[model samples]
Target: MQFVFLLHEDEAYFEAMGDEEQKAVIAEHFAFVAALQAKNAFSSGAPLAPAMTGKLVSVSGVEDGPYADSKEQVGGFYMIECADMGEALDWARQCPTAKYGRVEVRPVPDYGG
Candidate 1:
C-alpha cells in the first residue's frame, strides 16, 4: 500500500524561529527521511513554499493563492510505500512535523487501467 503524509504547520511559527532553531528542524527532517529510506519506505517528499506563493485554480478562474481559512497550512508532504495502514500510521507517528504540527496520513488507491 501507498500513503501520503501531509504535513501541516503554522507558517508564522516557523518564520518566527531563530536561524539555529530552523536549522535544527531541518536536520530532524533529514534524520527522519534517512530512517524511512533505511526501511525502504520512502518514495518521495518535499517542502512547499509559502501558501501565498501558490496559485488556486478553479472553474471560475485562477486565483492569487490557496488562501485557506485556517492558521495552519500544508507545509510539506511525504509519499511512502507501506505494508498496510497500520505500518503507514506508524511511520506518520514518527514524522518530525508531528512535534510542532500535524501529519495527515492518506492512502493512495490504485485503479486497474
Candidate 2:
C-alpha cells in the first residue's frame, strides 16, 4: 500500500523558533528524509511555501487562510509505497516534523482495479 503523510506545523510553534532554530528544524527534516531514502523507505516529498503564497479558490466564496483563521497549515508531505499501513505509519512516525507538527498518514486509494 501507499501512504500520504501530510506534515503540519503549528503556527505558534513555528513563530517561537528563531531563524537559526528554524533552519535547524528544517535541516533535521532533510536529514531524516535522506536517511529514509538511504533505507529505500522514502519515495518523494516536498515542503510547501508559506500560506501567504497560497491561493484559496473554492467553489464557494470561502476565501480563508491568508485571509483569516488559517492555523496549522500543511507544511509538507511524503508518499511512500509500503507493504502495509503499519510500515507506512512507522515511517511517518520517524518524520522529523512529527516533533512539532502532526503527521497525517492516510493510504492512497486505488480505482484502477
Candidate 3:
C-alpha cells in the first residue's frame, strides 16, 4: 500500500522565522527524508512554492492563487509505500512538519491507470 502525507502549515509563520531557524527546519525535512529512505518507504516528495504562485480552476474558470480562507496552506507532501494504514500513520507521526504544523495521511487508491 501507499500513502500520501500532506504537510500543511502557516506560510506567514514560516516566513517570519529567522534565517537560521528556516535553515534548521529545512534540515529537519532532509533528515525526515533520510529516515524514510532508510526504511525503504520513501517514494517521492517535494515542497511547494508559495501559495501565491499557484492557481485554482473551477467551474467559474481559472483564478489566481489557492485562495483559501484559512491561514494554513499545503507546504509539501511525501508519498511512501507501507504495509497498511497503521504503518502509514506511524510515518506521518514521525514527520517533522507535525511539530510545527499538521500532517494529513491518506491512502492512495489504485485506479488501474
Give the top-scoring candidate (lDDT).
Answer: 1
Regions more than 4 Å wrong, model 2 = 61-70
The segments of candidate 1 whose C-alpha lies over 4 angstroms from its true place after superposition are: none
Candidate 3 per-residue lDDT, tens place, 39-96, comes to 9999999999989999999899998886979889999999999999999999998998
Angstrom error of the Cα, residue 23, model 3: value is 0.7
Error of 3 at 69 (Å): 1.3
In order of appearance, the predictions have TM-scores of: 0.96, 0.82, 0.95
* Minimal lDDT window, size 10, model 1: 62-71
User: Cα deviation in Å at residue 107, candidate 2?
Assistant: 0.6
- So what's the TM-score on candidate 3? 0.95
Q: Rank candidates by lDDT, best first.
A: 1, 3, 2
What local distance difference test score does each model get? 0.95, 0.81, 0.94
Question: Cα lDDT for residue 21, model 3?
Answer: 96
Off by over 4 Å in 3: none
Query: lDDT at 112 for candidate 2?
Result: 91
